[model samples]
Target: MDNTIFAQSIARIRSLETKMIDKAKIEAMVESRDFNDCLRFLQDTQYGSYITASNYEEGLKSATIDIYKEMYKICPLREVVDILALRYDSHNIKSLIKGKLAGIDTLYLTVDAGTIPVDRLNIMVKEENFRDMPKTLRYYVEKAFENYKNSQDPQDIDITIDKGIYEYMLEIAESSKMEYLLDIVKLMIDTINIKSFIRINIQERGRDFMQKVLLPKGNLDKDLFLNNITDSLESFANKIMHTDYFKWVKEGLGEYIKKGDLGSIEKYGDNYIIDYLKKAKLVSFGPDPIIAYILARENEIRAIRIILTGKRNDVSPDIIRERLRDVYV
Candidate 1:
């Protein structure tokens, strides 16, 4: 837990961070006349070597997996990077499970950068065998798949696996004894639980449903949500006014009231994480810097995807900009 051990990793991260795309570059992509022009803009940067307009999506995905693998190899406290990689693993697991049951191809949606190889995960799911999966993950997968077989409710697959991801992440963060990493994981849990709370309330699902989906060990109590299931969104926001997310949740509630979607809440949640990651900018040597750098890269890739997808689909620039999160730089 001595962050000083990350001194070398921090220096390497510092050098790599300089190449991160900035707000100006993002704007250039956003304003590009077409998708090819956007790819051309990226070609001038780090991704130019392989990112063709025709293959930009695959190129970007492949590059993402490569960068994560590189970062994982370089990080001194692998636990931190492992925490992030676990997220991708969790996401890939969900995509694989759903794809299998739905008889669809979700391969493109998988991010193959986790500690568990994505190909192995695909094989496990393909054959409906998970014995080789991580023990905690395998338990959840079997239970979810079994529940789905009986109930035929897809939400079980998502809810159960998501809970398993956070639970296992908490275990890693706690076992590493890293307070910064622990806080990040807890915050993610809180935000996800809050979002689930809103979704369940809107769906008219009760405490039983809330208990099924709401993750434990967050800053907010599971009962806090279970008890407030009947309250109006406004009242629920008021209920949590003393918590860290009061202001952000209230603002998102305002938008949800006007727009009938959780988009604003989700955007605010993502930006909040970016804000937390930015704290590492002042640290001289620690896992924080490395964690911030890789998450920043992930965030950067997301911004690029948003712009390119918007341009390809003819989404308005203004709307696209609205959807963009704050850059880590």
Candidate 2:
């Protein structure tokens, strides 16, 4: 069966992922809160202590490198690697185009969404190799950049970029053979659409503006979202309640649509993805270190960023905690 190749590929990927996980635990010990334990772990793991003498942030770089180095030790599944590579490539493309359009310095944008190199990103953007990038990223860079170049409005650029990303992600997910991956992608699209709708319409913007910003993705019909929002939030919720996903947003939020309890929609979707993969890992064995683990780490990084930013701004931990997403252990 043709699936044999996929099965074999998965087996190799699993072996690699397990190796990385073990190595990562050792690295984590080096990064432990206890100073002496951390030092001992560092020595044991041979994670180099060469950090910038002038900046505390350099320690973060060193620690992150150790984490990823361990991850590399486990070996990644080809499909997992490809998916991540394409996602990061798309991000860099978006950053380049948006930075140019908004007149923001490229340095202000983050470089570490995945393993994308600055040199490769430079070449891709400089050459405008949208066609050569990846199927997952090609249409997004092209359409978003075209729209941004034509309009030059910051809001338009933001919306265009989001819409382009969602549309492209939806296309790929729909075509993908992996059921779990496709489900997660569709859920992500649903969340994006929901957020965009709320931000544009319920936030008092025009329906036309909402439509312009929304990506045409997911199982939900675009016209339904746009038309439903013309009524109250309850009506919209009720309309969605008929769908398979209605329970996710409706059960906890049905009573408080007026109070913005829906801000957690993104968090819920992210947690669901992580949880789904954690369960999948029990049944499957492959090189891909379960999408849940990756998403959880990503969420952890995001939470750390939010906390650090809040600290810098003197925002209370309470406020930061509210904004934090779920993390995997």
The model with the greatest TM-score is 1
Candidate 1, residues 1-329, lDDT tens digits: the string is: 57788888888888989988999999988998988778879977887875777767888888889888788778876788888898888889889999999999998799888878888999999998988877888898898898899889988888888888888899898999888888888998998889888888888988898988888999888789999997898889888889888877887878788887678878877887898889999998667887788888888888988898999999988989989998998
Clash pairs for candidate 2: 10-286, 13-286, 13-287, 14-286, 14-287, 16-74, 20-74
Candidate 2 displacement at residue 242 in angstroms: 4.3
Q: In candidate 1, residue 109 scores what lDDT?
A: 93
Clashing residue pairs, backbone N/CA/C < 3 A, model 1? 43-48
Model 2, span 1-329: residue lDDT tens: 13333454456545534533243443353234443333344343323353222332445444544444444444333344334333554465667766665556574353444445656666566666856555645665666667766876655555655555555555554455556556666766777677666555556776777677666657688887777666776667678877755665564354235456656665555555555556645545443244554554445445544544455456654666666655455
Worst window of 10 by summed lDDT in candidate 1: 47-56
After superposition, candidate 1 runs with Cα above 4 Å error: 102-108
